[model samples]
Target: MDVTIQELKQREAEGKNDYVLLDVREDYERAEFNVGGIHIPLGVLTASFDKLANHKDDEIIVYCRSGKRSGMAQHLLQQSGFTNVRNLEGGMLAYQG
Candidate 1:
């Protein structure tokens, strides 16, 4: 599942922190602009799987510079037994659009 930037904003405005916002972009990209998500670059996602083990059943919203990397992240998490995972439709690009 993919969510729009507006939808994400609405969730945030409503003070909903029930889900995990996973940012899979590179550090530099995140430093440039981000939505305040957990910083885990795509390259090390698998190795850092343990950090997310406790949230396997929680809704996770993955994002990146253009949604590509985060899409891969979403797939990886799903394969790793993550139940509710969603990709930001167009990542930060869409968010900043």
Candidate 2:
């Protein structure tokens, strides 16, 4: 599944933090600018799945520079038994901010 930047912003505006927002971008990219998602590089997502064990059933929104990497991250999460995962469509590049 996927979500647009506008939808994400609306979710934030509603003070909804119950879901997990995962940033699959690299450190440098995140340092440049980010939407305050948890910093977890895509390459190490599988290895770091344990960090998100508790969020398996929670809604997870993943984003990267573009949508590609985050889409991959979403797939891995689903394969690993994550019930609700969504890739940020167009990623940060499409963010209005």
Candidate 3:
């Protein structure tokens, strides 16, 4: 599944954080501008699984600069048994738009 920037922003405006936001961009990319979330770059996401194991059953919204990296991360997490993983549609690009 996927989430649009509008929907995400709406949720934030409502102060609804029932999901886990996972930023899959690199350190420098995040250092530029970010919506804030668990910072686990895609390259090390697999090794960082333990950091997210606790939220395995929770809604996890993965995102990156463009949606590509996060889409890959979403797949990896799902393959690892994450029941609900949603890639942010168009990712940060759309969010920033």
lDDT of each model, Cα atoms only?
0.92, 0.90, 0.95
Which 10 consecutive positions of candidate 2 have the poorest summed lDDT?
Answer: 88-97
**TM-score of structure candidate 3:** 0.98
Candidate 1 displacement at residue 16 in angstroms:
1.5
Pairs that collide in candidate 3 are none
Least accurate 10 contiguous residues by lDDT in model 3: 88-97
Model 1: residues >4 Å from true position, as ranges? Answer: none
Instruction: Return the clash pairs for model 2, or none.
Output: none
Q: Top TM-score: which candidate number?
A: 3
Ranking 1 against 2 by lDDT, winner: 1
* 10 residues in a row with least lDDT, candidate 1: 30-39
What is the lDDT for 39 in model 3?
98
Compared with the true structure, what per-residue lDDT tens digits does model 2 show for residues 16-73? 7778899999999999988886788999999999899989999999999889999999
lDDT of 3 by residue, 48-95 (tens): 999999999999999999999999999999999999999999988899
**Candidate 1, residues 29-82: lDDT per residue as tens digits?**
989998886899999999999999888999999999888999999999999999
